[model samples]
Target: MAVASDKTTWTIALVGNPNTGKSTLFGALSGVAQKVGNYPGVTVEKKVGEVVHDGRRWLLVDLPGTYSLAPRSPDEMVTVDVLLGRQSDVAPPDVVVCVASAGNLSRNLYLVGQALELGRPVVVALTMNDLAEAEGTKVDAEGLSRSLGVPVVPIQARRGEGLEALKDAVESAGAAPPPTVPQVFPEPFRNEVDRLADVLNGRQLPRYLIERLLLDVGAHIEDRIGLAEPDRLQLRARIDEARKRLAEVGCKTPDVETTARYAWIARATEGVVTHAGETGSRFADRLDSVLTHKLWGSLILAAVMLLTFSAVFSWATVPMDWIDAGFEALGGLVEGALPEGPVRDLLVGGIIGGVGAVVIFLPQILILIGLLTILEECGYLARAAYLMDRIMVRVGLSGRSFIPLLSSFACAIPGVMATRVIENRRDRLTTILIAPLMSCSARLPVYTLMIGAFIPARAYLGGWLQLQGLTLLAMYLVGVVVAALAALILKRTFLRSATPVFLMEMPAYQWPSPIVVVRRMLDRGWDFLYNAGTIIFAVSVVMWGLLYYPRLSHEDLAPMVADRERAEARLEAAKAANDDAAAADAEDAVAAAENHIAGAQQRQSLLGRAGRLIEPLVKPLGWDWRIGSAALASFPAREVVVSTLGVIFDVGEDVEDEGEGRLSQALQSATWPDSGKPLFTIPVALSVMVFFALCAQCVSTLAVIWRETGSWTWPALSFAYMTALAYVGAFLTYQIGTWLGA
Candidate 1:
């Protein structure tokens, strides 16, 4: 039978606890018919997918996963608001599908009980039946259906089992009258709830929401209704009296709802769920014993992170090389096709170069996201939070902050977005502020380049450890240490708040779904390309204009150009006469003449003048004008610093050529104009790397921070404080190193 009711589409809400396979079912049901956007007025993502079956269309709204509907944060508030139809943008669901894990039925059924209380037609889709069977537990689907007086279907969403039957159950439930589940609360609580329900009924609020407001302390219902101070206080006073009366009857009002809900669930599942004793030491538990141990787990986590970072550098190199060559070839083709002019230079140097600098990091980003997704899908990431909880708590953050900070190692944008899991406002904001100090993949290029050029490749510990790799590792460690210290300082000073208790449910380990991992990687990659890529591209073009503008006069360039041509002519003449030595000499002269002209052009450009102006400020860090200009130009994206240096040194900004050690060679050979001595000494290289490691050079990161925090103040503070720290850090590093004669 159809539940269309003459309408073309029926709205269905999919509700579930976290890690309940709800998203997997949604993906399998909707396939390619899904769209994602933020809920109106909130940054929490809203996913809606459509499925057409049996001449009826169902719009499935996937709500955020939460253990309960009580609102604690903005993100959690969205779940309650949508279920109660308080959100103006979304309609009330015709049928509610409560996805429950068959293995974890009791805890999962707590959410189902709330769903039933919403007075919507409900169908229970039991997922993870196989997991339950494997764990020596069995769920009686028929008994559950009879006990709850609702349709129950055991379905394997990942394996596509019983999906059609589940769909049929949904349509049947949607058309049937809403179920009348008996009230579970005591008589006193019921009276209070009924009284509140009547008042809410007069105001057009749902009975379910009213009951929630009566039960949930500090719920946002008053704010949602825009209750004035007098009425709000009066209603709150009534609720307190009701709660006190309930407490006087030997019932704790604060936890009464939860206790009664679980009691109801136990009765509903009595004789339905069969288990062989307590779940004793499953493989996940056994593994957790080693992986979550204090000493061994910490070491394992460190090793996993080390491997992750190492893979980011080593695995991404091949794809990065391909991207670099592709851009290089494209630039060369454009240079050949177009005549020499501003238009050609703008296309090749400004647009292509700028965009390429950002694009080249895409492979590394994809790899990191893919790996992290695997860790999440297989359920180890939750354990990571568990392992880091003690250390995170010491710094006045919840264990939830650990994931976002860990994610910052890949990129701070996603890392900041990950803070949505943290419900406390101060904890989330503190995490956002310190996230950039985690030293993301953007700093990898700078570290690798500087370390390779300056730090010798000699091995230590009997040739087991390479000095350069250790230096790279040190940079990352420094970032982590600084981030922890910054979090501590902010928690104690500016962003102070009582540390909230951290609670998390660890999902059982399972083989990661390839489809889920790939889909997530694509989502993150597209997000970066669409949002951050545009900003970086525009910034790059602006920097190019700054460096290319106010063209030098022909007379100013004429003498050097003439010298190069004359030297080239001499080389050709010598080659024609078969004079190899003379030809070599002429070639050297030509290269010298070209460098002279390039130097003159760079010094005279607008960017050059600005760099010269800032050089005095940076001289204490042992930087010359070129170094200062490159550093300034890299503000939009840190990877551009290498390309900017290539350009500044008269070498073409080709990623492939730069990787071939040309940029390093140029830096090594660079000398101060006034002193004519080497400029890029060991101390200077260390200073530069240290600065990049600590500086807030990424506009994309700042944009994401602003978006996540809903203000410019945090982003501005992040930029200012990081930049100041970088400057001081580099200044002390260089000054101290110079004094030590290193």
Candidate 2:
């Protein structure tokens, strides 16, 4: 399934309710032919996959998993637009495959009925048939197909079952006429919808949207249609009258739609679905009883988290070492093959070193994302939310926010994007504001570097617990704690709203598909590498330029060169005389002269000058000009901090493993010129780690926030508040650590 971008492709849209195996089906259908991008001016993520089936090209688009077609926010309205042929660049789906869980047919049919309203070719791909059969309930595909006036095929996407049948059904439906949509609402409601259509004459709004316009009260659709209608007063008056009539008839505006849709669904699915004598999910139920226990469940969750972080640290070490060595060799080769000049410096230090620093973390990213995808695919992740719901409620949020927050542990881009499921406007905003606080994979490189360099390797609990691992875990916890406090403050203050009740359907447990897991892992790893190559790549070059130029002339370096030459001569003479002590002293003098030249060159460079400019502000946090400069350079990309430090300390780009901390040793040996005191202590390292943990330094994340909220103000506010929070946190960390004599 690899169709090139051309005009020969027809688009097929997949729509379904949440937890209906929609994404799994998508993964099965698209395989590795898919690409992720954002839709223009909206929060929708465009996951388009190109496939060639039956000697023809088809583009499968997996829309957001939605429960209903009703539009509430501007974001939700994009769904309606895409299905109705109004969305830019996406032609109305030639065939719409409505994914339905066999075990939950009645509820799933609600969205199916709404899709039928589009009068487009429809096919139902029934998933989780095995799970349904296990519960002593089975769905008759032929019967359901007859009842809904469309083809229905049972499928188990995880196992590649019924995929050919599903594809055939979709192909057949595309060539056939549109399926029939049964009458849902009663006469009065239909009459109101018709009347609204008549009043908005020549507006050319689709008939379905007009129905939604009257159905979804106080929704964004009202504001959407009203903006262009010449007679806003007339439309509003008619809508008000329609709602009044609806109320008088005991059929409210929105609930009337729900009631009618479900009633029709029940009638259609009455005999199509049958219950069996035995329970299919009995074993699963028993397992849940133990897994959801208060004490055992919490401990298990902690253990699982511990295992995940530890694997990210320890399991990927060998691969990380291999990658680091490979980059080091490449840099060394480039240096050896080329003469020492600006071009060679840029290639060695800026490109290899800068990009290599980030690529070394690929193994860790793949491991983390793979683990997360497994947890989510196997259905344990949803249970984790159910387990954590009580705690989430105390902070004025429900468990739904936890999924996005947990995802942030991998990357904030998807984490922030996941907030679209949140229905409440203020609740969604609050979650968005704090999602960045969850330590993402970008921070992992920094955390690992700092912890490996500063934290001791003490073991406890029969060697199962290491101090370095605990320190890494503590950094993540700090983010969670601060996020909770931020949520509490936001909820109690201006963004206050009633804490929405937590409601979720626990999916049945199953073995995770290795194909899906690997595809997802590779996809995300590529995203990270692409980012490192592009934005981080460019930033590293600029940083090198800042630290490189305002070159030290021969006039300035001649004295240090002469001093080094004298020391070398003395060392040679001492060696000839067989004087070990004198030779050792001369070696120290030579090293000092070389250090003096490197330090002087860096001090007068642009980066050093800028670092000095902000030294006063960072002094309280125990950061000198060099550390401050690294922080400042990393504002666009947080992971660049490590590479920046490498350049500043003249340690090239390749940082070695824990056993031989090349950059780490350089940092420990650094000292302020005036005081001759060590620049990097444990407290200062802790402060730096804390600052990066809390800071909103990723420009891409802020841009995503702007896209999600549709207001630059929100992103601006997020940056301001997060930066302030980071400064105070770092200051407090350093102050307390020093006071405690750490």
Candidate 3:
């Protein structure tokens, strides 16, 4: 053990069994200084924080919770690395605080026992004291503390109790003398663990190494070690012999040494533990009745999902408007203050417009994550998964896929990374492949803009519903329907296999900690800005250049510029000659007149020439050249379709302008030259909106797909399949509508 020095900061690792409120305790101990980041070379997140306890500032590492030291997944590998000091980036923790849920002492101590075996300073924090007491159960805290050779403090973490005792134990551990005696393991298992340790002599080992040597089930562990073929064969033979010896003595060969550790823990826990009658908590029983009911469960899940989508659109509108207005004002500020040059264009057009395109969508992401975190923390998420499991199973997906799918509603990268939980390799890969097909937060801006611009606001079919709202709802449904259908096709064809079984342990329902919820939302928001925001910015720059440069020689544009300048000069001279009130009246007339002339010139510019060139090809689909160009711009990002239309129609970047104040309205009022019909007719707008809805219009999504799959093959296939689907779907919609005289 290292001595605590004035210059050295002690490292404390928060370790506990699963479902012991360790995360809550970590959040309580280290609040704002905590950072949630990914562990190196893996997507599994690590949280590190600093705390001042007993006049000492300690760095705390919150290790992932596990049932035992036996590593089962990638997340569990993090716990193993930190405990063994094997992670090069993080120092081994100086002290370990094992959080034991009072209601489940025996199981919790199994982890504590294993931690103690590592020969580190260990303190036990007994959490959920109130829950135990409410169930008429009592734990002899002091007696148990004596038996375990450590200090124990009873804590009701949610109510802020016994925090001082926990801190005192940490301080005492920092200055304490090392124990002389080593922990003894029992019988045949002890001998076998020793044999395995001898086999691993002079080599650094994972915490779960001994356990993995016992089970020999998964290939991942042994693969990491690169054990020789002969040595691995000998190890397997020794494990079989050990299992046979244990069976002869009427004992089972434990999967991990920690299993036997827990057996001893159970014996030590006797007499100090008692269970209450009925064996169930009232709150849990009540919640399960409604939340887990087969019929009501599905209905509640549907209602919750519907409400979440509706709230995402309705609630985020005000904040989105404010963000839009702020960007617009900032753009105008730059244009007014800076001299007319590349710097001004860069500020107003390139940087502001490109960044604003992504930033304005932040409110939608925040609201969506907030709602999701509440549902997840409140225990409804598990029940929703249970309800969806039957349908998911039919498509060769486990109930575990539900969370990833739900996460896809926010972003696909996290959703793809989340598939690490599905133990089956085939199922996990399939989930990763299809996750991007589900609509994401990035698609929301496109959906809202298109639906608002194109779909009629008035209700149809005698006020049964607003056609526009239904169209928006239908767009969401299209993604869901396509995703499910794609899963079915993939399962039946390429990734054909048995549907993996879903086995989940549901947690007791409790109110979420507001601090944790807010932290989660902020983490997600920052992740979006840092990850997806950068890609959108770069793509926007390319798209902006594609539409902006190759200027008409200024010689070609000189005629239009000279004409506009002469007209503006005449209007200014007329305003100067008039009286003050008359000049104000003339100002409005001059402004509208100038706007119309500029709008016309833009329509005849190079972009307009290209739109006209492409108009014939798109005319059958109910789009003129301008709509065609907007659709083309939407390839990099669908939301760019909205802003591009604004630019094309000379509606300055103000997003909140409505009531004949938006370019979409100008589009709606404009007529086709040859057809003598409105360009944005009901069928045409719906078809275009539908096209935007289903396409892979996000570069970030494609990038994530590439990163996650570790190949461009899947993303390329995804793009091809989705673009084909979008075009065909839009084509069918347009043709059918025209046939019906829509």
Candidate number achieving the greatest TM-score relative to the actual structure: 2
RMSD of each: 3.5, 3.3, 5.1
Candidates ranked by TM-score: 2, 1, 3
How would you encode candidate 3's per-residue C-alpha lDDT over 28-89 as one tens digit per residue?
Answer: 88877888787887667688999987567888999877776666677677777787777777
The digit string of per-residue lDDT tens for model 1 on 421-524 reads 78778889999988998877777667766775687767656654566656776788888777888899999997899888888888867888888888878977
C-alpha lDDT of all candidate models, in order: 0.81, 0.85, 0.71
Off by over 4 Å in 1: 1-4, 277-280, 441-473, 528-533, 634-689, 698-712, 732-742
Off by over 4 Å in 2: 1-8, 227-230, 247-250, 277-280, 653-658, 674-677
Scanning candidate 3 in windows of ten residues, the lowest lDDT window is 652-661
Candidate 3 stretches greater than 4 Å from native: 1-7, 16-20, 99-110, 125-144, 153-164, 177-186, 202-208, 244-262, 271-280, 328-360, 455-474, 525-542, 554-694, 697-712, 729-742
Candidate 3 local distance difference test against the native:
0.71
* Cα TM-score of candidate 2: 0.93
The TM-score, computed over Cα atoms with residue i paired to residue i, of candidate 3 is: 0.82
Error of 1 at 66 (Å): 1.0
